[model samples]
Target: MTYAFGDTDLAARRLALLAETFAPSSRTFMVEAAHTGLRLAADLGCGPGYSTHLLAGALEPAHTVGLDNSESFLDLARATASDKVSFCCHDITTGPFPSGPYDLLFSRFELTHLQHPEAVIELWGRQLAVGGRLLMEEVEYIGTTHPVFTSYLEIQQAMLTEQGNSLYIGPVLDAVPDPAALKRRSSNVQTAPIPAERAAAMFRMNLGVWRHNDFVRRTLDPSDLDDLESALAAIESGRSAVSSVEWGLRRVVMDRVDP
Candidate 1:
């Protein structure tokens, strides 16, 4: 499952597939994001609009912006985008983010991709409005119940690295980004429960969710395809599925205190 810079299209396709797998959990994730009252939210590295769609309808804000560098994704995003929302395609790290002081700077699985997710966090924090919150959903590979899923994931990950891709931080959450600076305002984290029947799909779904730079397809290999099929079958039968095995998700919410 080695990835190459040339395979962006394939990577996008694979992530789109994975997004379909985790589509089941979108509602729960969205509900929590909305309840947080993220009025001026920014979906950084928004892939195929998974959480963006959820956020747009969930928040009653005047505007929500979906940001990403992928032309493929922005096209789909624009088509699926609500009239209340907007889209932008640009390299987030290099390009300036749309003017902010945003009520919410939210991103799922986007931070970990950065060589320094923490640094990115610091930058995003600067964009927060007074009383704004940053809700980040990140995945770390702890382990898996299904042998095929775990092995397949490791292989895929190794392949991605070989292709010069840097992954989001490993699932060891505490190391991700410390909230010591953020705690003053108020911060908390929780893990989303994954049902066993959905395990295989869940793990693969997490890996596949990035959809960043058409990541999955570039990393895909014959073996990876086999793993995906097997996991999908297991999930369909409500049996041991190839999900995020041992790794747990770390959701960190940092809010700016209104002084």
Candidate 2:
């Protein structure tokens, strides 16, 4: 399945900003969930290697691999590779993963873009060593009173829904029964409040990437999109004193159980 956001340079830039904005929350999650002396770790859908680097830094795994399907993104990721960190161009959802029996598996904001996330989680769990952990952070809710933010979110959600994916997939994942090999250890929501300008910046960059999609073109008025873009630009420029958007991220931790 194609990512709704293109893997162009602009998209990479957006992801960089996204990584910067969300790193604190993600780092905290890793520190809280990780065990000492992990042998191997994988960061799923590790676009541009930001989250991969974060994983390595936070957990200090003996070896860490970042996986993504985009060669363009992998190229950027490879530039920053080290003895402990590496990049692989692979689709995360379908995997006999490059490395087996990982001690830790991490994915952030990736499931919302994929179909059958529960199955994906199960697949990831199978690649973990016994008692290894799989950690996922996905959107539960996005709270904002800004009309532009609301409008953009609605359109994005509709487009994802049309694609048979969900924008806020936390609840869906929460309801998934634990697979035999992966027992749920913890599930909870963590709030990350993003500054209005920063939120608009990310949203604007995302809109630019997916605004030309067939679903978007067929369903939305071009003029409205243009106006929406203008409104987002205003917010991104700090001209609008909009309320900060609060992201309620669902964090789930599962342990690979012995078969």
Best by lDDT: 2
lDDT of 1 by residue, 1-259 (tens): 2223222554556556545544445445556644544457788877667667666766656778888877877877788777678888756665347767687766766654554566666667667766677777666544555565556566556655655444434343345555433433323344445554555544444444433335455766656565666665677477643344333555666776543
How well does each candidate superpose onto the true structure, as a TM-score?
A: 0.69, 0.98
Residue 169, candidate 2: Cα error in Å is 0.5
Count of backbone collisions in candidate 2: 0
lDDT of each: 0.59, 0.93
Q: What is candidate 2's lDDT per residue for 155-213, written digit by digit as tens?
A: 99999999999999999878888988999999999999999999999999999999989
- By TM-score, the best candidate is 2
| TM-score, model 2 to reference | 0.98
What value does the lDDT take at residue 135 in candidate 2?
A: 95
